[model samples]
Every structure is written in structure tokens, then in C-alpha cells.
Target chain A: MSIFSNLGIRGSILGLAAIVTGIGVTRSCDGGGIVTSQHRVDLTFWNGFTGPDGRRMLEIIRDFNRENPDIQVSMQRMDWATYYNKLMVAAMDQRGPQLFVVHASTLPRMYRSGFIENSARLYSGSDPIPSADYDPYVLQQVKFKDQYAGVPLDIHPQGMYTNAEMLRAAGIQQPPADKASFMRALRLLTKKSNSGDASQWAFALTLWRNNFQSLIPQFRGRYLKPNGDADLNNPGNIAALQFLGDLSREKLIPPPENGLGWVGYRQKKVAMVWDGVYMLGDLLRLQGLDYVAAPIPQIGPQPGTMADSHVLCIRKGLSEAQRTGAETFIRYLSKNSIRWAAAGQVPARRSVRQTPEFASMPVQSAFARQIPFMMYPPRTPVLFEVTLEIDQAVEKVIRGNADAKTALDLANVNAQRGIDRDRAEQKIAPAGGIQP
Target chain B: MQRTGFLFLAPYAVSFAIFVILPIVVSFVLSFMRFDLTAQSSAGFVGFDNYREALQDNYFWSAVKATLLFALMIVPGLLVIGLSMALGMNAMARGQAAVRALVFLPGMLNIAVTGILWQWFFNGEFGLFNFALKHFGGQGQPWLSDKAFAMPSIVLMSVWWTVGGTAIILLTALQQIPGMYFEAAALDGASTTRMFRYITLPLLKPVMSFVVVTTSIAGFQMFGQAFMLTRGGPELSTRGVAQYIYETAFNSYRMGYGAAMSWLLFALISVFGIFQIRMMRRPA
Candidate 1:
């Protein structure tokens, strides 16, 4: 109060504004001043790798920082569940990091919102990681409109994790590769109590969304029409859901519950579980458990499995030097993706996958064998809502609460409504034109 | 003197204005606008469109139903358990302070820790509860997964986690009741039951009303327990309004719609609070 009296009210307001402006100015100039004085560019990177993979990523970042004296990339990590919300809020405030990681399926929403930088420029020029190096299917997921939105780092596809000891006990030498053998193995391995309760199951549906999505495509079901309409109620998808329902009805699989499926598999109460390569580290930590990774047994007509990638993206509207530095870091990560794969991932780059070291990782190599047929969920701005609807549908069917046709039909309507709302909010025309 | 008083209040006043009042005002304004974070350019005045959409939204209704169900389950249980625990502790002749501390311990745990601990207990297979059941030759109940059990299971965990705080408040209120009143009643040859009915219950009425209203409000705003336990699963049976609003605002980025629903929930809580206060204030 005495200070305010001395300076006067207007003078105090001006002083406060000046202080704020001074702080802002120093923050804005810090990067440039350091770059000009020491010839070093500082880049901020953010990602949701808050697991075993995070340690691996931290190691890589440290190595990059040590090797590249001219560039400093500081990394921040958070859990994936809340990561997108924080990233979006920061982006809206124009405080987004220069480099970030996003799942390939999430790119559409970010791209549509104009949050991500169009990375087509990185594809050209000297020492570029060529587009040919990535699997075309995985690379295509990062493409939005006519521009590439990000670079794929690694593919994490869901594969069948089998209890090898349980299979051997059932007198089966090899894991099932197709529908008939798979059913036979299930029948042999499943144990029932006198009261008709399943004491042990042959398979437990872990991550039901991925399991259903993988099976639907193998059954020749299209998740979306070419024109971007939901095709969830199609015959092929119905058949897929029916098959999953039958498994529950027959007591071959237990009802999907929290931590039950994975815990059951670990305790040898279940024989097989379809989960992602990210779980390999957790499985490996368990002693005296013999496990093997194989392609999800072919349940339908063709070989297919659900896959997602962790892609590296840049925020829009960076200075030219900043862009260059971010690009260089992305290229370094891409080239060194083999080390990323060591954290239980399939390297996105074909050259990295071909390396003998990658082949030596049995689980990763087994999952990699299905790279050619891996199917990602439909790329849509409203994919989150779509996924929730699909998850609900699958849960209902697997729980024997609703018949497949009814659940799929209801989910189809709900998903279409979400898509329509998204289109209306974004002022986007219906699908024969540019996707919303 | 006034200047010194203002100086003393300045820190709290400034923070309250910035963090609490400002957000309420902003969200009030945002409720009328189409404030989709994903499409910033599309934000504009929509004049009750968001509210209308919430009225038509089935999930909104379901969330409301779930929240009300949770409130019904939790509020009565909290009041009964809290009062009983407080009375029991007050009647203790020895180790009163230690018993009170033991009762209050769970309330000190963070919600996340509480949720995880209870989640381990409620896991259908390989959980402490199920393991105990197997040991006793009983079949394990689907604690978190089934539609019928999910909300009740969450309520059980929440009661364990939060009852301590409520009981402590009631205990303080119990201790504040003068010994003179009970002595006077004893001189009148009143039985223990009659004394409790006439003296203790009457004296504790105001505090009981406070606890009931606040507990009901907190129950209506329940999110963490259900979120950590079932994640609104077994077909969205346990998903409360707060969780739905969170998903709408943060997950779906529909700020306007979320704010609209939040105001509706606020209105519902206010109505319930007023009703409870009025009912509790009436002489039985």
C-alpha cells in the first residue's frame, strides 16, 4: 500500500504490465540468444512414454544430446491417458513443444485441428529418412490430406501370447495358426468344474477392442465405407462378433474383467491372450513362465491383426532454425528406431527390421512377421467416439448381454451421430469430398 | 484498521478470485458459446444449443441416473456409519485418542492410492477378497465387472476411504455436547435411549444436517472411485455425471456441452441441498 501510494495507481499498473512484458521478452529471446551466442539450438520434446519404453527413450535422448553438441533436446514424459489433453491445451495456448509423439490413429484429429506441422519438407533434401524405408501401410497412416503429418517411429501390433507349457501339457507342439487348430487347442486346454464353471480357460479376451477389431478385418469386415460411413453392422463384422460370443457361451474364454485376463495368463489359469508387444517386458519379468509370441491365429478368411504406431510430430509455426533442429532430431530417432524396438516395439523402418539384432528379439520378430497384414482402425477425426462405441459393442456381445446384430446396429447409429456432429462442428461436407 | 484487515485478506482473496471465481464465471459464459477446443475458430454464441443438446443426450440422462444412484447409496451409509463410529469412539473409556486416530487414518490417504488399494481388493480374480472367498469355500463375486455390483463396490470403497473424515467431524460435535445436559437427564430418571433421543440427537441435529448436505453434494460429484474401479464399465452402469462431463470436456473437447451439463448438475445439487437442510431443520 505504501509502494502503491508512492508510485500512484496508474503507475503501479504500468509497472505490473512492464514486469509481465519483461518476463515474456526474456523467455522469447532466451532460445535465440543462446543460439546466436553459442551456436546451439535448443529443442523441447514431449511424449507419453511413461513406462519401460520411457527409460529407453530417455537413454536415446541423452545419447543424442551428448553426440549433437550444437543441438539440445530436452524431453518431458507423461502418462498416455492424460497426455493428449495436456498437449492440446498447450497447443491452444501456443506453447506446444517443438517435437512430440502421437499415436498414428490420433493424428487425424490433431491434423484436422491444425495442431501438427506438415512434415512434407522433411521428406526431401539431403540425409532424409526416405518414405520407402517405412512400411507403406504404416507410413500411409501419417498422411493427412496431401501432406505427411508425422514420421512413424514403431508399430505395436497385437499378437497372441501363448503359455507354451500349457500347450505342451495339452499335447500340442505348436501354437494354432488357423481357425480349426485354434478351436481344437481351445477344446483341449480348457478345464471346467463339476458345476460347469470354467476353472481354467484356453483363451481370455484381453484388450477386447483390439481383439475384435483384428478379427473383423480378417472376417472381411470393413470398419468404414470408402465414403467414410460406419460399416460396423455388416455381415462380416456380425460373424466376427458372433464368433467371439460363441467363445464366451461355450466357456472357452472368461468374461473380460479388469486385470483378470492378464493375471490369469500369468498364473497359468489361461493358455493364450491377445495383447500388444508393449506387454513383452512385463511378461519377461515373470520368472519360470514359458511364453511365446505368435500371430493371432487366423479366425476368419484372411490373415489380419490390429496395429498402432507411435509417430513423431512437430508443432506448427516454428522458426526455420527450430524446424531444422527438430527435423534432425526426428531423423536421428527414425534411424535409431532399432534401439526403440529393443523396448518391445517393432521398428517401423524395414531396414531396421531386417537387421540381425532385431531378428534376435524373438517376440518382436514374431509380431513383425504380421507387419504385411496389420490393419489400423479407420483414420477419422471422431475416432475416439467411434472407438468407445465399438468397445461398448464388443463388451456387450462378449458379456452375453446383447446379441451381436443388435449391439452392432446400435453402435453403428451412435458412431454415425458422432461423425455427423464432428462434420457439423468442423463445417465439413459429407465423405465423397475431403474427410472432415 | 480496515487497511490492515484488507492486507490480511489479500492473499486468499486474490487466489480465490483467480482460481475459483474466474473459472466459474468463464464456464458460465462458455456454456452459452460453442467452445470446442479442437476447432477454436468455430467458437461463437450458440444461445442454449448446448443445453438443448444435453437435454436430448441419452448418455447425459444415464450419467445423471448413475450419479443419483451413487448419491443414494453413499449419503445414508456415510451418515449412519459416521455417527455410529463417532458415538462408539466417544463412549470409549480408554485409548479414545488412539481409536479416533485409527478411524481417521484412511481419510488421510490420497484418492489415487485409495482407489488402487480397493481395486486390488475388488479384482474378480486374484484379488484379496476373492482369495478369501476361495479359502472359505465360497465362489468369488464379480465385484467390479458386473452391472449390479460395480456401483455398490465403488460405494464400499468410497465409504472406507471417506467415512473417516465425516466421523471425525461428528466426533468433535459429540464431544462439544455438554456433560451437564446428560447429567440433568440422568437426574430426571431418563433411560439411556430416552436421553440419547432427547439430548444427544437434538444437540447434534445441526451438525448432522451439515454432514448430510455436504456428503450428498460430494456424492453427486463422485468421479474417482467409479473411474478407478470399473472405469464406467460393464456397459456404462457406474459412470457418474462428473466422469461423463470430464470425458465430454477433456476427452471429446466439447467445452460448451460439458459446461452446460456441469451447470445442470450444480442446479440439481443445490436443490437437494436445500431440501435436505429444510427437512433436517424440522423437529422430529
Candidate 2:
């Protein structure tokens, strides 16, 4: 009753109707109550899949609705930019959907906020989603303490996009796989004119945050530790930044301005770019540009790249039937996520990736090669604050305001302060704490 | 008759109370409480702690600096451009209506459309400005990406988007001045510049004051232009106080901190508003 007060009197009546309907369906199963196939468990689903991926998700939802006569799921989609704010507000007010999608990186904040349910029970039930199908790292991201916060759907990782024509023109037969080959390709592909200006560039940095993050791990550095502490101010991180900074200084790559580096690739002025697998769709839409996708070159000691997953989450405080309906919907979506990968995502399920059809996807299959070594941002409730500091630090380094070490050092201090603030606040409230 | 009049006012009064007054009151109370919407523990009164924290927060100060910088750039820019356009149109005896409408046209566009259109023009790599610059053998300027140019770039777009409305207002005010005073000064052996300075300037003081007060208030509350253009990026140098407050509340889920900042912004706007009115009240 108190929860419904925020909705006003008329809304409270509608809320009561929804609860009664859930109860009515439950009572029908007790044997004496009226049972009808017309009584379907209606569930609302929300996601930030407003792009081409949304059509694939809609098809899955339609299939689920068709297959399950007793359950119907309706989905709402919005741009990722404003989706989290709306979801947070709605969930806080007890007006959120029965099911929703959150990025795996966002799970820590969402779980600590108390708006998401612990999904451990769903994985333990009679028909459970195969936990073995997911990578341990991906699975760990969806866990808060020992409880599962959500289920992974797919992972999107950074992949190196190469211009095949440019590669051929430069007398390169295959994409570069190491620092030696990459630098050689960059030098060979670069074209200079009589006027001392480079008419064509070798590479450009798009989405600085993601680009730098992917590089940091390749250099044997981690942005955040397993326990979610800031590890940005490290030698590996500094080396990664210095490598990119040197490239910009040497004119091997364009300066990180406008964040429109993809435009250069599309225009055939640049030979290579390191961007996310999700950008494959846009590249595919180009009329004449022949491009190939491969794992980002190993610039450091070992192979590493940045990856993030779309996690299927259930809202807290749902009726039993709605919760069950949501779990079933998640399982259906996860099993059929090969279709989701058609929009350029790599399905998180190992079995799904092993399928012949999944291998047929040129971009997705190539990007999937680095999934074993991919990393996500720190799993902290203060993820937003931490990311904010990282973005600024990365920007400062790229814009030539500060060197890599200085920028990362400042960011580390600020990020640590943010973590401390969050810890202190959690101590005061303790309600959202997952620790026993 | 009295009851019917009360009925007519009741709907508006109720809506005003619910939408405007209620939110203001709630925000005021929330400003003093440690209220995080995401946290499990209920809101507790923490009185002035949030306010003190805001004062000490570097991000808050930087955001305030960005906002103040925006206001400083935009208020004068709008006034000068708007006044010049108004005076130019005022001098034109023929086709005044079409020219006035043409000058006021950009104001009709939504901020989203305006921001997007300008974003393409300001983009460094593929922007229209750079495209044209390259054609003329000029270097491409990093309009929105460079910290030095980001706020000014937003102000430029804002002036283009909004100057027409301000010009129209000043044009209306310019037309309202009595012609007799100018004519009398002209007949009294006064030169064009002197007559303008004495008669035109004195008569436009009230309207100028109104424009200043209103433009300053609008400038102080600016959010959409920068938000759409740069998202207060390039190291958060373009982030205004309003954007910061929004990010605090919505993105960070720090409700009490957000509310406290909002109240602080409100107080700052009020103080500036009052000071402008007072300054403008004096005879210029």
C-alpha cells in the first residue's frame, strides 16, 4: 500500500488489479479455482537496444510469446544514453518492468542500489540456464557477493578494423598481429605528399575511453582490481598511454579530436581503426569499402581487450508468477542469442559460439577470438564516478595537457576518493549491502 | 458568481500546487536530508552536511566555473547581436516585416535540432566548417574538442539559435520609443550621434534593463546547448552547474547532493537576478 501511494489513488487501484491478477492465476493452479488458457502472465521487459539490435530482440520476444501460450512478454526499447536514468527512477518508484537489460559492467551499481533481484534462485530451479555455457569472468561480473545479479546475454569487444584494399595496396597480405607488424603496416600504409603533409593516415583512435581501456589491459595493466579498487596508476597503463601519445606526436595517427575517426575510415583516407564489434554494422552498410575484422593487435606482453556484456536482469519485488515468467523469458532469449549476434554482438554462451552459424558471422566470429582475455571496467558500485575520472584522465593525456603517468596518477587519487565516499555511504545505510 | 470564478481558478491552482510548488518544497526538504534513492536506508536529516560537502567538492567548483563562463560569454553576445540586428531592422523603411521574420526564424527551431545541426558543422574531421576551410587552404579548427574553444563554440551556436527572439523583443521596444523626442532634438541643432546619444539612449533604458535581466537569467540556467554539443566533455571543462546537478542526481543517484546543488544554483540565480534589476533600475 505504501509503495502504491507514490502512484496516486487511481494508479494504486490499477496496481491492486495487477496483484490480484497474479494471485488469481496462482489460485487457478490449486485445482478448484477457475483455470483458463486466456489467463496469461503478462510481463513487461525494457532494454536500451534502440538500434538494429532491437529488431533481433523483438523477433526473440515474439517467438517467446508464440511458444508460451501461458506467458506474454512486452518489451520497451530506448537509447542507452537515457535508459539507465529512466530505469533507475522507475525501479526506485516500484514502477519498473518485470524484466530489463543492464550491461554486465553496470551490475555492481544496479545490485547495490537494491533495484535488481538476486538471480541465484533462477539458476538453481528445475530448468536452469546452463551456467557452464558462460565464461567465468563474464559470470563473475553478474555476481554480487555469491549471489547472481543477472544472466549474461552477449559480449561486445573491441576489434581492429582493416581496409582490405589499403592492406593490399601496401603489399600486406594479412592483418598485423603484433607491435612489430602493426607499426610496419602503419608506416607502409601512410602516404606523404611533396608539401610535407600526410594526405592519407595509417590509423585513428575512435571512442578514446574504450580505445585506451583496451590498450591498458594489453600492456598487462588493469584499470580496476578484482576487488574493484583503482589500479590505473601503474607502469603498464602509463606505457599504453605513451604508445598512443607517441603515435599522435609522430603523425602516424590523427589526433583524438571530434571522435569521428570512423569517418576517416569510411572516406578511404585511413587504412586501419580499432573500434568495437558493434560498429561492424555501420561499416557493413558502406557501399564500396572492403574491410576485415580481427582481434586487436597485441601491443603488450600478452593479448588483452575490453569487453562488455548485455545482462538480462529481473526487477526486485515481483510476484512469483511474474518472476517465473521473467526467468523463462531470459532463458529463451539466452538460448536463441545467435539471432542477437546477427546485430554484431558475440553471444556469451560458449555452445552458441561453437555453432557453425555463429562462425559464419565474419565480424562476430573474429572478434570472439579474444573473449578469453577481454576485460570489463571495475565492478564497483561507484562505477560511474570511477569512469568519469578515467574519461577525464584519458582525455587529458590524448589532448597533450598532461603525460600518461601524471594523468593516471590524478585519476587514481580521485577514483580512490570516490570509492571511499561510496564505502562510507554504504556503511551508513547498509540496507543495499550484499555481504552477509 | 464568486463560486464560479473560484471554480475557474481551481484547476490551474491545483496543477500549479502539484507540479511546481510541490516539487520546489520537496527539493528544499530533500536538500537537507541524506537521501539517496538507490540506498536501502530511509532518508535522514543531515542538515548542511551536503551543502558543506558541495562547497569543498572540486567538481562542483569546476561546474560552477563552466556555468559562469557560459553566462559571461552568452549574455553580452546576445545583447550586442540582438541590439545590432534590432537597430539595423529599425533603420530599414522597406521590407521590414520580411527582414524581421527572417532574423527571428532560427529561434523557431527546437534545441535538439539546432544542437545536432551545429554539431556537424563544428565536428573537426568531417564537419562542414572544416570541409570549407580545407577548400580555402586553411587548417581545420577543433571547435568543440579543444577546451579553449568548446564553450565559445556553444555560445556561438546559442547566439545563432536565440538572437532572433531577443532582437525581436528589442525591436518591439525600439519601436515603442516616441518619435517626438528625436524630432525635437533634431530641430534643436543636435547632430545625428548626439541626438541618438541623448534622446534614443535615455528612452531605451527601461527596455534595455528588461532585456539584460531576462537574458542574464536565461544564460545562467543554460543546459541544452552544451549538453547537446559536447556533453560537458573534453575533461568536463564545458560542464555547467545544471548539467553537473543533473549528473549528480540521475547518474550518481546522489539525490540529497543533487538537490543541495540545485538549491545553491537557485540561490545564485536569485542573487544575480536581484543584482541586475537593481543595477538596471538606476538612470543610465
Candidate 3:
């Protein structure tokens, strides 16, 4: 300070300022060198392909990462058990993966929840797929409230499996084509002579919901009309219910206690079953099991069969670049859907189905044929509630909980109430929307 | 001494506070809000609304009924099977360990695997169960798909997988009983059944209480069998509360509602659980 008094206070202040500036400049440079201006983007993809399917998806993702160095995409394959959990967390946190795969059947809730984006923008302006290229039913299945909420990937329809050996032994050389033939084939195949006098169905039905829903279209029944309203009381629905009841009553299908359809079919205990394509992998592994896939033989007035689809969709609210990247990946999978077929699903791209490569595959092509006729449940936001009630009601009916009409009637009531209540609640919901 | 005790509990306190207490508090609070999955950060308070909706939900009730039904069928049966097996094994000293391991081995496998394995076993035709029934001249029953039979079938599978665990627990309890009890009963001219009823059962009460409550809790949260085998079908007969909450929170993106349902189940379990706790506190 004595030296500073001679030099003046300003000189000392200048020295202090210079030192502080030098330190700040050095720190800024050190930090900025690493984080300067190179922006890195993360694209997260979430899916529930926790099997060989998951591994295949991983391989594809690995290739994608290898090819693209700038954008890093992280693929998370989760078990179905906690998939929705992961999605919900991501959604609630507003850090959702850029892309995700969802079962088409459950997307209604996702759509209503606003977890998915309307992707029509890509296809609207001169998309490769002519609207006519898609199956009418599937085209319809892809929408929610007139918005193209999802992009279709695969149709995992219910196929009636014929135990070849059992059917042949029953003197049936050909699988049933319709209700009459189905009855005859079943009658000939099922022999209760071993189990009991009372036991009639040599056929067993498992996972009655799948069995019932698939039959809904056959009976000209739908869980609801297209716009999320109850249509259980419709004649088509009734006819389907009657057939199911008749099948149970006539002992054409065993009450669930007996090995249900797949178990019974694999064991060669039952001659027939209606099950999803997902059952193919398990059936293929059954040591002595030999079965053939066929259309769930049109039992009702319409030839339509029931099914659930797996959809590939972009998570809502991604950036333009992320959306573009996601669209690229989605298109890649859609084109290369044959890989998905190995996982026991029917791919959605019409070209995939027509390919000699795909058609030659034993079950994929035959099952794929049913895609055109496959009936998805109505694409209503409240589809889950309606389906759940119908499923429960159907079970009770089959379990003799109620008569076919009465059961369905009650189911109708429950479905409407659920739809109504859900709408009312949705209306009242703080406008932020569904979390996952 | 109190300080030492506090020091000893420090690690547990930190873990419990972080893992259990914090998550519970978060879940409870989240249950009151309208959680938006797509909004990223848009959540607002909607107090008691989720609770009201969940309470009004028929499927929620269906799930509750199903879960209770599962507990009702499985808990008692598991306890009985476990005790019987434990007693049977205890009486056999030669291959006891081997038999014990064999009985307990299924529990070691996952529930999904167990579900699949038993799906085959209880299968109508090729299932070992129906196969045995047929071999024994009994009628084959549709085990997994029949609404009337599906839940019971699941209970049967659950017991098969879990009886081993209960057996192990009860076996530990049985072993803890001094040899003198059995010897005294034998000298007192007690029949095997009488000895079990009077002496063995009375001594096994604590284990029984533990086994019952634990098994019931497990049964109440039953998911794998329903998820893997029936998928809450042959109708929602097998739809347990856990599946419902899981689906609502995750599948439906209805976190608030799911939280509400879970709390409801929590309350239900607490009522049953408190009784078990009280029973276990009895002076033995």
C-alpha cells in the first residue's frame, strides 16, 4: 500500500483485474475445448422384444449405429412386464425415447393418453404407400379419432391350428373350412371314450379372451362399433356368443380346466384350437406336436377373423431431426419385415407378404393370408375397458356365469358405462393428458 | 448402548429412507396428481379424483376379487401342503435332504418358467396332471381356460411351486422344536395324527403365522401365473391386483389411477396383515 500510494490506487486495481481476467479466460478455454460447439444428439428407441426378436432388433440397431456415427441411438429392449412402466416413466419425465414399438391392440389407450404422435404428415404429402395398398381393415385400424395415430407393422392374427395326426386319425384328411365342417372335424377328432361319458369336447380352448375375440368377427360381433361405443347386443355379437356357448355346451371345446387348446393340441389331446401367431414358436418346439395353420374356419356369417397388430410408432413431441431419423428406422424395419416374421408375426407391408421369400416360409405366408380378413377391435380410446368387460362376460358365459345373451347384455352395459365414465373423466382430466 | 444401537441402525436407516420411504412418499403424492405421460412436465393436482375413479372401477374390483380369491385358495393350501411335506420329510431321515431339495427345487425356478411348466402339467390333454388323471381313470378338466377352473388351476400351480418354500420354513420351525416334544408325545401314547394335531401344530404356530401371511402376500401379488399362462384370462378370472395396477400405470398411462388402485390393495393387505402380525405376537 505504501508503494501503491506513490503509484496511485488505479494502478493496483488494474493489476488485480488483469489477474482475474487471465484466470477466467484460462478456465473458460479449458472447459470450452471439450464442450465447445459440437452438439451430440441421443435417439432412444424402446421396445418389448425380450426374446430372439429382441436380439434381432439389437443386431439391426447395432448395424444402424455402426453406419451412422453422428447420431447415437440407444435401443432398450424390455420385458413386457415393465415395458409400460418404462414408457410411463419416460413420458411423465418428458424424456421419452424418440421411438417405440407397441402392440396395436393396446394402442387405443396410448392414443387416448396422447402418448403417440399423429404421423400422417410423412405419408400425407406423396408417401410411397398409396392409400389403396393397405388392407381396408388395417387402414381403418391405424386411426384414432380420424388421426393416423400409429403406423402398422405386423398382424398377429388368431389361427385355428389343426393337430394333423389327430385329425388324420379322426378320418379327416382336410381341415374344416366353415362352421359345419368345423363341427364335423371336431366331432370326429374328440373322443371322450377315454376321459368320461360326460366329456364331449376333444377340443380345448385356452386364453378364452383370444379365443372369444377372434370369434367375435366370425359371429359378426365386434367389441364395439368403430367409434368406441358398445355394440355387444348386435346380432353379429350374439351369433358369436351363441356359437361359443354351443361349442362349450356341445363339448366341442372343453371348459378351461382340461388342458386348454394349445396344451391339448400340442399333447395331441385336442384336434383343433384358435390361437395367436405367437403360439407358433412354442408349438414348433413341442417334440411330438405336428400342427397346420388354417383360417379360423369362418364360423359366422362373415369370413373375418379377429387379431391384434404390433405397431411401430414414433413417440410424440420429438424434434424435426429426431422425427426424421425415427421415420428412417421405421421405414427400414417396415421394408425388412421378413426378419420380424421369424419371430412369429405377419408383417404389414404388402410387399413383404408377396415376397416369395416370405410366402415360402411355412406358417408365415398362410397366416399372412388372413391379414386381409383380420378384424381388429374398434379403434376407440376406451377399447381396453370395453374389451376387458366383454372378455370377463364371455368367460362367465363360457364358465356358465350367465346365458349368452344375458352375459353379453351385461357386458354391453358395462362397456357403455365404462366408455361414458371414461369420457366424463377424460373431459374433467386436467388437460395435460395421459402420462404413458 | 442406545448410541451403539443407533450407529448399528444407520446403514439400514439410510437404505430404508432412500429406497422404501422416499418411493412410497413419492407414489402417494403422485397418486393425487394427474400425471401426463406425453407432456414431459405437465402434472397438476387432482386430489382424490384418482381414488374416486379407481373406487368406481369395476375391473379394479374384479382384480381385487380375483386377488383375494387367489389368496383364499392358495394361502391355506400352500400352508397345509408345506407342513404336510415338512412332516413327511422330517419323519424320513434317510433321503430327507434329497427329497427336501427336490420339493424345493421348483421354487428356485422363475414364476414364468413355472407357469409354462405347469401350463403343460395342467394342460387338458398332454399335461402330466390330466395324463395322470386319465391314467387313474379321472376325467380331464380344462385347467387354464375354464373360468370356473382357471383360478383354482393357478392356485394349484402356485402351491406346487411355493409348497417347497413353506416346507423349508416350516421344516426350520419343526427342527427348532426340541426332540423331546415328539418323544414325549410318543411316550404319551399319541397317534401320529394326534401328535401332529396337538403337539406339532401347536409348536408350529409361529411358523404357520409367518408362512400364512407371507404366502397370502405372495398370493395377493400373484402376476406371473396370470401373466405368463392365462394373461388374466380364461376371462379376467386370473387378473390379480398387481396385473391391474401394472397395466393401469404402464399400459394405460394412468399413473394416478394405478397408484390409487395400488393404495387400495395396500389397504386391503394391511388389514389382513395386521391380523397376522397380531396373531404372531401371541405368547407361545
Q: List the residue pairs that clash in candidate 1.
A: none
TM-score of chain A of 3: 0.82
- The candidate 2 chain A region of ten consecutive residues with least summed lDDT is A28-37
Q: For each candidate, give the TM-score of chain B.
A: 0.97, 0.96, 0.89
lDDT of 2 by residue, B60-91 (tens): 99998998998989888998899899989999
Please give, for residues A1-436, the per-residue lDDT of candidate 1 as tens digits: 5887899999999999999998777546543222433568888889998888888999999999999888899889998999999999886565778889999988877776777888998788887789998878888899876799899999999999999999999999999999999999999999888966677788898878888988877888867887777878999999889999999887678765535577789988989999999998788678988998899899998988889999999887677777888999999999999999988999999999999999999999999998888889878877878888998999899989999999999999998898888778778777563364
DockQ-based CAPRI category assigned to the predicted complex of candidate 2: medium
Model 2 CA RMSD to the hidden true structure, in angstroms: 5.2
Cα error of candidate 1 at position B273, Å: 0.9
Model 2 CA deviation exceeding 4 Å by range: A1-38, A193-197, A225-228, A428-436
The candidate scoring highest on DockQ is 2
Root-mean-square deviation (CA) per prediction = 3.1, 5.2, 8.6
Q: Candidate 1 chain B — worst ten consecutive residues by lDDT sum?
A: B122-131
* Model 3 CAPRI quality: acceptable
Per-residue lDDT of B13-131 in model 1, one digit per residue for the tens? 99999999999999999999888777888889999999899999999999999999999999999999999999999999999999889988998998899898998998876789988
- For each candidate in turn, the interface RMSD (Å) is 1.9, 1.9, 3.9
1 or 2, which is superior by DockQ?
A: 2
lDDT of 3 by residue, B1-284 (tens): 99999999999999999999998998899899877453324467889988898888777888999999999999889887888888888889599989988998988999878887887787665689777877887867777767778888888888887789899899889989898987988998889889877888888887788888888788788888888878898667789999999877665556777887788888999899998889777876
